[model samples]
Target: MTTDILTVSCPSKRGIVATISSYLASQGCSISDSSQFDDVETGTFFMRVSFISEEGKPLSEIAEGFTRIGAEWNMNFEFHDSTTRMKVILMVSRFGHCLNDILYRWKIGMLPIDIVGVVSNHFNYQHLVLSHNLPFHHIKVTKDNKAEAEAELMAIIERTQAELIVLARYMQVLSDELCRRMPGRVINIHHSFLPGFKGAKPYHQAHKRGVKLIGATAHYVTAELDEGPIIDQETIAVTHAQSADDYVSIGRDVESRTLARAIHAHIHHRVFVNGDRTIVFPASPDSYAADRVG
Candidate 1:
């Protein structure tokens, strides 16, 4: 069975669903899983549909047939073959928790992505990345060579034709120019205690304040720093009995899981960026199933 995904975003109006359903039926496609949302505030509609080509229609033909419907609705849409894995680039620094977790998932077939390479500002994880038989690029950055370093990073992205960049606990601050160039294509993970716990050692700060909740946030990378549109978040309960080191341990676990979930959503095409916010659809059936339990 050939599984394909269709994502559509356009102004909210009548008959959008009917038109889409009718077109898919005409193309001999059976809708297996579908999710749609109409934002009343913004008058925008988002939909994600997973279908099987019952009549064995080629994707090119099916997509060609949908162009008229797309034009009629003034839609922004894409037809993606679910079997095709998206190419992704992972960036990291000293932190290895999120990096290690993602690598494990990818190795186990949990994350359906083609990791083009791993980029780091330091050599901390060079051996870790290489052990997986993956290419690793060590591009050290400093105050004076930040621009040059980013240029080399861009060169890697272009050469590999990476579709997404995952900053898995990368410590460097990306330049505004890079943010603007990529827009919603970059994702980053960090501790969720923003504003409340600024600067270094956020978990320590939270412990100092006797906070009861520790969490992590995964979001798109933008020029405004950590203020990008959120994609996924998670929290763990803490107690006064726990030490700051305990908080750090719990926080790292949360960060790793949150980042993986966010990346999963992105690679599956379930995330739709709308203005400063996002509308993330639920996963299609069996989309999260790993090839192996390990």
Candidate 2:
């Protein structure tokens, strides 16, 4: 038996489930697990179906055969081979917490993706990444070398066939061109609650403001820093008694966990961009682990 994962989204209509399940039954496919949602206000239907294809059916064949049904339902969808891992390329500079977290998750099979390479403007983490046998590139960037460095980044992404790019506290500002070209394929982690103390030393700023809570945000990387559609955010309450360093300590954990969750949602195709905001559907841990593409 061949296991396949299918996803669909379209205008809500009566009998969408019946049509889908009956079509699967007619094709001799057995449903293993399924989930669906109907947005009453928007009249949108969304579904994720995991099924086993009878012997002799492969993912490509199943995908090819679903065209008619997809067309009939006016669906926007994808058919994925559940076992294939998504290829990822990570970029970071100075900060190691997010990068370390992702690396550990990947090593432990918690994040089902292949980290193709690590790119850094500094050499701080070269030995740490090399210990895992993954390639690390050090292409220093300055005002004069920005173009050349980005060219190197693009070259690595192309050669590695990287489908998703993560900025794990990568401090450099990306050029306008790369942001447009990559669109929704990039993810970035910000250390503080965005739209507030934005630039550098966010923790210090928040602490100085005497704010009662600290937070982190994980969002898509667009041309504007910290302005992309947010995917996930988490907060940890604080008090005036805590210093900046204390905030930093607590903030690190929030940053890593928030980024991980956002990446998980992105990889699973559970997030949808709605203008400057995002719509993230609820997902269980098992459903979360199996389908994530990021």
Worst lDDT run of 10 residues, candidate 2, spans 284-293
TM-score result, candidate 1? 0.97
Model 1 residue runs over 4 Å out of place are: 289-294
Q: What is the lDDT, from 0 to 100, of the residue 59 in candidate 1?
A: 92
Local lDDT at 201 for model 2: 91
How many angstroms is residue 265 displaced in model 1 relative to the true structure, after the best TM-score fit?
0.4
Q: Pick the candidate with the highest lDDT.
A: 1
Q: State each model's CA lDDT, in order.
A: 0.91, 0.85
Alpha-carbon deviation at 51 in model 2, angstroms:
2.4
User: What is candidate 1's lDDT per residue for 1-294, written digit by digit as tens?
Assistant: 867889999999999999998899988999988999999999999999988899999998999989988998999999998888899999999889999999999988999799999999999999999999999999989999999999999999999999999999888999999999999899999776455885689999999999999999899999997999999989889999999999999999999999999999998889999999999997778475422354
Q: What's every prediction's RMSD, in angstroms?
A: 1.3, 2.9
